[model samples]
Target: MLHATGSKKELTRLAYYALVSDILEHADVQALKQFRHHRYTTRFQHSLNVSYYNYLLCRFFHWDAVSAARAGLLHDLYFYETNAYDRTESPGQKSHSAHHPEVAVQNAVDRFALNPLERDMIEKHMWPVTHRMPQYKESYAITFVDKYAAIVEFFGLGAQRMLSHIRRKQTV
Candidate 1:
């Protein structure tokens, strides 16, 4: 429902909502809210942040906005504590950044019917870090948006909104 740190937008009212509303309500996606991420943001919010901003960027460029939005939301689909990983990726084992895109793609394919672009976006969002080349322009949008989401969240820009969201959830 929001994007970036210290920024709030009317998400459901925007065209962006219609593109992602289908999967956003799913239990798997909602489950992201339970995992802490970016210190102050939940994975759900982080993904939403990426999704909305990516959609806007792609839309502005007259690219495939739908795929960009959908992929952004599904990009970080894996659910695990981010810091719970071996610092070094062993010969056979992958570091979390290198491994999660694969995990997320597997999880996404199992739950949703993905087009090739969506699949590419979800799988290659990590880009040079994952050493995976993106197959489409929209794929590159996700990589930027994902990083933007992380930087904003890491700096605690969205903490006030998240706190209010938590307070409202508690009241309900």
Candidate 2:
């Protein structure tokens, strides 16, 4: 990663290494490549979107950009297999969405040797909306950004499909 200018360079370095290491350890390259090449809406893209939103929120709040980006990127570590939802669900049962975050937190801690703050951010990113309320300011920042990104991704998927439908109609 390029060196970020100004105050939090050291902290950013620490967070960046830990988070990237965690991602590499957990994410399968074949799966990621298949998702990217097959045009699947993927955890990788989701993570990137979350990271971007976290950057925006961090800048707005004067938080550590590196830490925020790391937290966002690593928040969905257990989502290496995009079909997890399909595997866990049986016919009528609702999605097992709530479990992934805890699974992710555990995997991240074990894989990356995360510090307390980094762990907190990964663990609490689903706050208010999914999990319990976040305690730390960093956790709160992740929570805010995660939710915002989710909404944006939701609308983005809709827009993409809408445009595809329009193009299909024109072709026909």
lDDT of 2 at 32: 38
Model 2 accuracy (lDDT, Cα): 0.61
Lowest lDDT block of 10, candidate 2: 29-38
Which stretches of model 2 miss by more than 4 angstroms?
Answer: 1-40, 79-95, 129-131
Clash pairs (backbone) in predicted model 1: none
What are the Cα lDDT values of the candidates?
0.85, 0.61
Total backbone clashes of candidate 2, pairs 3 or more residues apart or in separate chains: 0
Count of clashing residue pairs in every prediction = 0, 0
Q: What is the Cα-based lDDT of residue 6 in candidate 2?
A: 19
Candidate 2, residues 23-97, lDDT tens digits: the string is: 534544213323431133456556655665676578678876667776676787663454656576777663445
- Candidate 1: list runs displaced more than 4 Å: 1-6, 87-91, 156-172
Residue 161 C-alpha lDDT in model 1: 71
